[model samples]
Target: MTKPDPIPARLAALKTTPTPELKKQWRELFETEPPSFNRRYLESRLAYRIQELAYGGLKPETVKRLEALGEQLDGGNITLRRIRADRDRPIVGTRLIREWQGVQHVVTVTAGGFEWQGRPYQSLSAVARQITGTRWNGWTFFGLKNHRRSA
Candidate 1:
């Protein structure tokens, strides 16, 4: 039987590798200056690179499909850094519309917060409260999240 790959052990060792050595590995793997993140970042990225090379990275068709999807998601402006930046936050320039009491309201996501009818609010919940005149979880009201269970 084929022996198990030794890459996993090496990846684990990366957690304890010296910062300088990790930087060297990073350079060899990516052929660029390592980002100025932290030791854990270096180790994780290096590990992924090692495994990707030993095995194979994503298929060409998969890459193309993902690129097409990214373009559709972000109008062809998607990048790794951009996706990471927007991962935890809503995509800027996206519009959210909700109807309350026969009136439809639109909110646009901004860098700082969400804009509702020409006013900026820090959170969707705030806008929901303003619109409903009652406490609410904005995501649920916006249909972005499931309704909260009543206890």
Candidate 2:
């Protein structure tokens, strides 16, 4: 007879397992401290880890291809990579709209850069400069900056 499948049971247990126990399991499986993210993040990552261990992770070539795509998006700039990694970076094909002095401006996000007023710019700051005739922080001018709450 074939051996029973343990993967299903393992994945199911993650749903009911206590957060501390999940962290312990994460330590054992990932060999690192668990991130300070919420319980749902832990559960999902633990489930993926269990499945990855049981089956396998992505192939090396696939990983390489993904990395290459990421590099193309960030153009190998460390600062750009950090910004691109941010959740606030607008996705490709997003349209950012802003009105300056009662004149409406629209910018389209592209795979390589941004387009505004029939011109392509490498950075949103350049588009903002063109709109306002002054230098501006793209994220702030575009209202993408993360706002922190005070206690």
Candidate 3:
């Protein structure tokens, strides 16, 4: 019998595939085509080609879907609290004192003005709003600087 044309040569190329994933791909695609003498090998070759084609030409939609799916599979949410600090003594007026972490600074509040570590500020409320926003906890009036005691 006459030997068939050299399709087997094409199929033989699948043997050089370096990975198991490529081997599996060959198995799946080879199953679809008609049986040549080297059908098993050709299947692998076809699978490799398919894999190479797929890897080389990924669509944006596929990339986005994969990213979304990955996020869905392994994802979580987080809540963040604004960093704050306490003062050894309160400044005058409706001042809100706070300290930012990772910095050597103290903020003080007063009715007429605010101070950050003694730097004068326009208004205590403005300073408070800057450090802690509109609503922050833990501030109250206790006593004025005892001027009479100095006398």
Q: Quick one: best lDDT, which candidate?
A: 2
User: What's each prediction's TM-score?
Assistant: 0.48, 0.53, 0.20
Clashing pairs in 2: none
* TM-score of predicted structure 3: 0.20
Off by over 4 Å in 2: 79-151
lDDT of 3 by residue, 11-49 (tens): 465567545545455556555533332435445557456
lDDT of 1 by residue, 30-122 (tens): 999988766777888898899999999999999999989877666665475455444655579989899999999999999987999899998
Candidate 2 lDDT tens digits, 33-87? 9986678889999999999999999999999999998778776788875564444
Deviation in Å, model 1, residue 72 alpha carbon: 1.7
For model 3, the superposed segments whose C-alpha errors exceed 4 Å read 1-12, 16-55, 76-151
Clashes of each: 0, 0, 4
Which is the leading candidate under TM-score? Answer: 2
